[model samples]
Every structure is written in C-alpha cells, then in structure tokens.
Target: MELAIGIILGCCALGAGICMGIGAIGPGIGEGNAVSKACEAIGRQPESKGAVTSTMIMGCAISETTGIYSLVIAILLIFVAPNILVNVLLKAIGLM
Candidate 1:
C-alpha cells in the first residue's frame, strides 16, 4: 500500500467506473437514436423500410460492441483484479 500504488489503484478504479458508465450511456443513447432515425426513415419512405431496418441493425451491433468490451473490462477490473492483487500481497507477507 505504497502511496503511488494506492493512487494508481484509485485511478484504475475511477477509470474503470467511468468507462463502464459511459459505455452503457453511449450505447443506450445511440441505440435509441438509431431506432428513432430508422423509424423516421421508414415513415418517410415506407417502401424502403426493410433496407432501413437492416442497416440500422448492423450499425447498432457495431456500436454496441465497444460497450460490451468496456463492460467486460470493468467487470474484470472491479471484481477480479483487486482480489488477485490482495492475494499476491498477502502471500508475499505470509499472512494468507
């Protein structure tokens, strides 16, 4: 628990939190916006609704991938790394 390591850990935690929160926000907004736009397009061009729906789906899938990665990283950071670090430190001190 040196000062520098503590600071680094805090920063990592903050970054991971921010990443996950923003990731969820961005994708949710993007998907909503995409759906809205697709609906508008369909309303304007009823004959091309199928094409609009397909493109919207593809774009949403691509946009959502980044959010998924962020979630996975955040989960690993928050749930996995701290425990592993604690175990390593405890073993090094022969207290575990």
Candidate 2:
C-alpha cells in the first residue's frame, strides 16, 4: 500500500510536469505570433495602431491566461494533490 502511494505520487508529479510542458508550448508560440502580427499590422496602418495594439494586448493576455491555468493545474497535481492524499491516508489509518 505504501509502495502504491509512492508510485502514484511519482506518476502524478511526472504527469503534471508533462502537462505543463505541453501546455506552455502552444500558448508561447501563439502569443509570439500575435505580437508579431500586431506589430506588422500597426506598421502597415499607423492610423489604426491603437486598435491593433489593444487587440494584440488582449489576445496575448488571453493566451497567457491559458498557460497560467495549466501552471495552476500542475501545481495542484504535483504539490497539492499529494499532500491532500497523504492527509487522507493518515485519517484512514487512524493516525491523524
């Protein structure tokens, strides 16, 4: 039972890392592309730079939000879940 718990914790940590790693990739690329396009658009149309800059900032913010969400999930999985599980296990074992 203890071995199983250890294995589960390890898997959770690994999974969380993998999830965050995968999650960061697409959003990073997308945010980069958004800024690039926004700058290009502004350069092409100086009069509309304000609108383009605002839209770019909004899009980048949204894209970054996804990465933040993933980081939250990863932290929960790696740090929070295992601690909760250990507490639950102690309670079950009548050691808490």
Candidate 3:
C-alpha cells in the first residue's frame, strides 16, 4: 500500500517534470524567433518602431500562453493529481 502511494507520487512528479520540460521548449523557441524577427523589422523600418514593438509584444504574449498552460498543468499534476489518484486507488481497493 505504501509502495503504491509512493509510486503514484513519484510518477506524478516525473510527469510534471516532463510536461514542463517539453512545454517550455516550444515557447522558448517561438519567443526567440519572434523577438529576432521583430528586431529585424525595426531595423528595416525604424520609423515604424512603435507599431512593430506593439505587435511583437502581443505576439510574444500570445505565444507565451502555451508555456503558461503547461505550467498550470504541471502544477496540477504535482500538487493535485497525486492526492486524487491516491484517493481513487484507495477507494478502488476498499481502503478509503
């Protein structure tokens, strides 16, 4: 029983770690690309810096949502999933 709970918790931690790791990669790359492009645009059209900056900010913010979602899911997996899973396991085994 204890072993089962330990395994459940360990798995949850591992899953959360993996989720965050994979989730961060996309946004990191996307944001880097967006910023790079934005810099290039501003360099090409210095007069339109205001517009380019605003658009870049919006794009970066939108792209960052994916990473934020992954963070939320990871947090849930780490802090919430283990307890819920443990409870379900206990109930299924008639211990809860």
Residue 81 of candidate 3: its Cα lDDT?
96
| Per-residue lDDT of model 2, residues 1-96, tens digit only | 688679779988998999899999989999999999988898888999888988889999988988998999998998789988877877887888
The per-candidate count of clashes, in order, stands at 0, 0, 0
Q: Model-by-model lDDT, in order?
A: 0.85, 0.88, 0.96
Best by lDDT: 3
TM-score of each: 0.69, 0.74, 0.93
Q: Which parts of model 1 have CA positions greater than 4 angstroms off?
A: 1-19, 92-96
lDDT of 3 by residue, 28-68 (tens): 99999999999999999899999999999999999999999
lDDT of 2 at 17: 91
Clashes of 2: 0
The TM-score of candidate 3 is 0.93
Looking at model 2, report the run of 10 residues with the lowest lDDT sum. Answer: 85-94
Q: For candidate 1, write residues 25-62 as lDDT tens digits.
A: 88999999999999999999999988999999999998
